[model samples]
Target chain A: MTADHLRREEWAVTLPSLGWLLALFAAPTLLVFAVSFRPADPYGGIGAGWTLATLREMARTPLGPVIARTVRLSALTTAICLALAIPCGTCLARVAPRRQAVLLLLVVVPFWTSFLIRVFAWRMLLHPEGPLKRVLVTVGLADPHTQLLYSEPAVLLVMVYTFLPFAILPIYAAAEKFDLALLEAARDLGAGPWGAFVKVFLPGIGRGVLTATLMVLIPALGSYVIPDLVGGPGQDMLGNRIAQRAFSDRNLPQASALSAALTLAALAPMALAALVQRRPPALEAAARKEAA
Target chain B: MRRSRWPPVVTAAVLVFLWLPIAVLAANSFNRSRFGSSWEGLSLRWYRALLADADTWRALRNSLVVGVGATLTSLALGTSAAVALHRHRSRLQRLHYALVYSPLVVPDLLMGMSLLVLFVALGADLGLGTVYLAHTTFCVSYVAMVVLARLQDFDPSILEAARDLGAGRWTVVRRVLLPLLAPGLAAAGLLAFTLSIDDFVITFFVAGPGATTLPVRVYSMIKHSRNLPAINALSVLMLAATFTAVRASRRLLQEDRP
Candidate 1:
């Protein structure tokens, strides 16, 4: 086929999905942004005129605290996931190939199961009258009346559990491709063991660390189920408030505002990363030479 | 070449943290007690109750219908997009790539909420049809990603060879491309199906009255119902289904690697 024929064929093949996403994904996402600027009708619909009232409302005390709590918890979850995943990925990379496959599969199994069911499992385990509480009481580590479910720590714990695999897989993928001999080379160059690790090993897998952070942080920030099932009223995150506005409160414009804020917040770091990546080639080359 | 012991120790501890809840859930599925606070004894009563629950079965049926619909639709859309993406380079393709990729990064809740707003604005009644649409939107992105990864290692010379052998355009696609793409298609289909059936947050927003999927049903049951053990039993069965599907997809992908 000629290049023109191939181009026509490509357009033919691409148009269907392109149209579908444009209608459902792109248009709807833009609608969310547009609706955020509109006024909420008292009857659970968008009003005739547009205004910035919803955006300003987001800065008020009620939603402000939820946003803060969401960011804090998500940041904590990302940090904890990184700390655990770095070591875990390093070990998986160091293991024999056959064993590495099995270990990776183990990590993926829980992730494949239903998200709701996993959260429910945590609920069952952390139930006030459940076996865990019984064991803790038996070990004298907790009083009989102590609660495990519907607490901030429980929310954090489950958030970590839910997002841990996401962190591990990317780090493991990057680590698997990483050359371990570099560590030894650094050590031979008279760097201390810790120094070698901090300087060489971490930088070698830096891409994975960034990928893992984004993976964990994005989902953890938008998490609705974990906080809903495990967190009490005081621990409500932005997701919970968005859900509340959309469903219970029937405030569509407010929900859109919250959703828009969240979409922007999630995309900000990615945009920053892209900007950093688009630096001048000369600068990149200079940085490469410096590293060498 | 000496390995530090701390990494393995942390891995084991993290694995335990991951598996303990699942183990507890599976074990309690067979518990005779209603609350499952403590096991009275091992019994299949909860499983029996779960089997006999009409609402649960109906929800599962709904999930399967939506899953099959979404998977087939996404496979067609995603495979075509992947092929076009792999073969072509242009500003339009870049835009297409961004559209295909954004869903993967956007939060599920936002996707659901935005779609809900769209439907509301269009005066479209929410139902299983809306749920199917919402599921297909995200599933297409996943299927495209998988198929694109498969396409990365594919050789274009195979298609040229078929054409050089006097095969028509349709014949070459039928005889060469489809066969070569079958494993990828199958893997992507399984993944899409798994994701569609397992989805909750999206379905939760789009589903109308009498359009409840399994996850939505289970969420309400967990929130309200007294039958905790039956939910446990249901979760175990769902977990088993997920394991089989994921394993099969992995095997297909592994077999395709040459």
Candidate 2:
């Protein structure tokens, strides 16, 4: 083909993605950032004033506490999911290839179901009159629990359950790519199974763990629904507070400011996770081969 | 590898934890008990009641419309965009990638609220149509990212070979590229289906009075009453349908393995 034709074809390949990005994401995000600066009229329309007062109000409200709680809860949830998903992922990696699809589907089954329905189901499972409490009572764990549904544990449970798949996919991708020959060689040199896992396997899957952590942590940090439906009174996350500001209190300024801050707060963990996800090229290619 | 005893045991326990709530809700939907705890005996009374409830049917229909419509739009947009990105090498590809993936990182509630503001300013009317637009906006990226990952698995040499064999671009894409990408597209479409169905926050912001989805309907019902029999029945149906689809996909994925 002619050089000019090839150039035109290349441009044909590039423009649509750039167009979608410009129209859908870049413009929309700019609109949001611009909204943060526009003055909120009392009647819910933008006003002439452009000031930092809305941000100042964010400092005085319950935003600081909400942010702190979100971080603590999300961190705990991520750590727990990691603890559970890693070994499970390792098993999938080490097992027979024939069963991999069924096993992998199991990991993602919860995702296929609605998040709202799953959380709603948890209500039935955790309520005082629910099966969980009945079982606990039958087992003599205590008198049927009264506070399980709205407690911190409920929030934690949903968080972990909802995001655990994120943790598994990455870690499994890495662990499956692990150098079996390396582990075999170590075993030949008298390394025990546990020793091989620690020295050989863990480091191999570290990037996957890091990426999975990112996959879990970012969404968990700014989560809105779980805390609202399952979180106890006075233990609200920043998301609920933002919703309240916009809807109930009609305080759009404070709401926008709170959202902006929450977005800003999530950047650090996300950046750290992204940095960790950028593994050595050899490691990435290994993961891809394993995936194949 | 041999079947170890520990994995099945662990998998069983985890699956039980995962599936029990859904199972309970499904069973209780048939129970005569209003409290949702005891087995007062099986009954289809709740299903009859759900059929007569106009609001419930409306929500169900709305959700179907939204889910199917939204998924189709995303599949089209995302597939095209992923194909374009897959073909060309550009200095800005990573930046473009990071942008598409950004929606995944931000919480849905924030996106919902900011979008409400943006849409209002731009004078886009809010309703079921608006919900469709909102759903497609985020859904495109998700569908794109997954399809892109799948596209990366494909060897570039195959496309080059098709081109070198004197095939035009359209012919190569139609015959060679599209067939190979089928599994990835279907997976992306199914995933988008789940996402559209699960969505509430964005829908809540963008949805108008004429269009309430199933989740919104359930939320509204819970707000007004404690009668969960119907809710449980609906939940059961939803769970079963999604699980069946997922299992079927898994079976196909396994059989399709090269």
Interface root-mean-square deviation, each candidate: 0.9, 2.5
TM-scores for all predictions: 0.97, 0.89
Model 1 CA lDDT for position A122 = 91
Model 2 steric clash pairs: none
Scoring only the A-chain of each prediction against the true A-chain gives TM-scores of 0.93, 0.87
Q: What is the lDDT of residue B176 in candidate 1?
A: 92
lDDT of 2 by residue, B1-258 (tens): 223366456556666766776677788889998877888988998888888788888888888898899899888878877876776566666666777778877778777877776666666777888788788888888889878887888798998999999899799989998898888888888878878887888888668567899888887776565556788777777878888878765554445667
By summed lDDT, which 10 consecutive residues of candidate 2 chain B come out lowest? B1-10
Place model 2 in a CAPRI quality band.
medium
Lowest summed lDDT window (length 10), candidate 1 chain A: A275-284
